[model samples]
Target: MKIQLQTLYNEYLNIKWKRGLSPVHTEPFEYGLYEDDSADLFLSGHSEATFTNWMSELRPEDPYYGSKPNGMPVLADIFNQLDVYDELVLYYLLFTLNTTMSIHTHNSYSEMNDWMKNYSFFQLAQLNGLSSLNDEQKGELRDFFFFFYLYTHPVNEETLYACSFREQDLIHTKTNIKLEHYFSAFHDHYSENRDKYGEQFLIAPHEIQACEQLTLELLRIIEGKSPKLSMPSEEGLEAVVDLINNVEQMLQMYAKNRTLVFDVMRNFLADPRTGLYRNHCFTMLLQNYASYILYFNFDEIHALVNDFRDTPAWCGIIINKIFTDAIFIHKIMRKNAIDIREYPNVIEFFDEQAREFCL
Candidate 1:
């Protein structure tokens, strides 16, 4: 809820009453102080002596306290006027739900179909602002107060952590699957207008510089060394240096081999022989690239490519091998009559997650 001084004051008064403090005069301030303690009003009004003189007989610690008039106003009466506080609380709660609902947020809003009746807290808040908060706003406050908790609290909350009131119908698109196409189109357009780009072809020199740093880092990670430029051993160092030299030579060799490089990428995606190698590489490449964007460093991708390329073939081989192993494992386990579906929560959540990702 949007924090406000008025509500804070009301809550503060509530806490005071709970602590057994006197919050109000036996009569309204309109009548001023009671006749018995009339002189105690302004002489340091908050002093212990001030409280003692006015309420000393009713004091809980007094020797004969039970006989006193017990002249304090009830907490329920002071707290009964809380429309302003309730409205502010509901608005803040709804505001939190408006964020973190994901792209599927619009899929379940219909559940709040009675939002117009119960959730007019948000509406009236927008219309009249807090100025309309008074005895008249009580009906609106009571209706919407509970729903502020209901709709925003996720269904199957053991799975979802954030507060997200879902919308009625969620529309899914192949956004992630299409990222490759978009990035490739951008690269192609950039390549076509190299003259216009002038200093922007960003080839040759960048490849050389990036390769130098990337190779040293890759060698360190490949050998499981710390992040540094030092090559620890002569034998391993020579192999590392040679790999860099071959990669540079291959770059020059492939200068006119755009067709070959692209064919490699396409096959890498399609898994011409089997899908496991390509899938593993896909995970490695994707995780590395995602981390690179966030961290703005080559360490992640460089380490990923290093470890991923350790097999006989690069990306395509690992993906195929992993998938083959997974399928074999599944079949053998099934033959023994042990079903993975026995773990219902894991199975269901993963199935739904797969559907969502594929969607």
Candidate 2:
């Protein structure tokens, strides 16, 4: 029997959040297995006591877990166990479910957050089995994943990383998969979605360019390799502020190298001799960038606020902005269930600034 991939995918989505199918772990990088009954989430309208049982009839041996014990099922041999269509359904479920259940993250650096690693592990597993497919099957599989990535993930979040992973997967697996084979189809898919869905389907190019430029300059200054930077133009300043205002864009920028950017900003704010702090435009940029520093590294920001030294009175504006951002980020982190121990006690820092700035 031929199985339609989209129909199977829709069916999986329906049962993915059913009572017994939810993942057992919610912590970052600590993805555990779904409940035993989750096997039915992909069992083509059938149910099984466990994922292993669901696959027992299809494979010659028991499915083994990958790097993470008891995390997700991995079959070493998928060459001839199932028909081509069923294999597509199986691979789709493996990839989509792994991404959905893992801790949601924007960081592409696996060392900082292994959420991508967890998702890519199963992805490589699926790619390893692609050697058995013909050109048509390979094209279908690529489109299946490309469409899903666009459908579920926002462009400002994981889109770039997803694109990177697909390219890297080819190298890692050494399969005959031709990325160019699907480029036209992928663009058409995105265009169709954009046409149907409107602005939510778009990425603002100007905002991205501004973020890239600002991030590069900040990185240069922190490394003591100044680029003879000039103050941003009035419009440039507005673009920078716009990038900061959009949390998803800010996250996309930070995911490049969060720790390095945090360190750069922390050092920049701590030193009083940084002449840029004297320029009105530079000062505004500093104030806005500090907000992101606080958003990403509350602990370091807390220390920066506490370690303030004697400086020009105008520096108070930067301090005030930091304090305000701390309050805002604290509430945001709490609302999103982000576990940041430094957030609760941050009010004291803002309180001190409130008095000093007479706000």
lDDT per residue, candidate 2, 12-51, as tens digits?
3223323233433211111223454232322222232222
RMSD of each: 30.8, 20.3
lDDT of 2: 0.33
Local distance difference test scores for all models: 0.28, 0.33
Worst 10 residues of 2 by lDDT: 24-33
**Candidate 1 accuracy as lDDT:** 0.28
Give TM-scores for every candidate, taking all chains together and pairing residue i with residue i: 0.15, 0.22
lDDT of 1 by residue, 1-359 (tens): 12122232222223322223334332101112333322221112223222112212311232223564443322113333323322223223222222211111123343222222212222222212223234344333322322332344432232122221112111112111121222233234334443554542334332223222322322222122322122111221232222222323323323454334323333454444433222323333232122111122222223323444433244433323222322222322343454444533223323333333322
The C-alpha stretches of model 2 lying farther than 4 A from their native spots are 1-183, 186-298, 307-345, 349-359
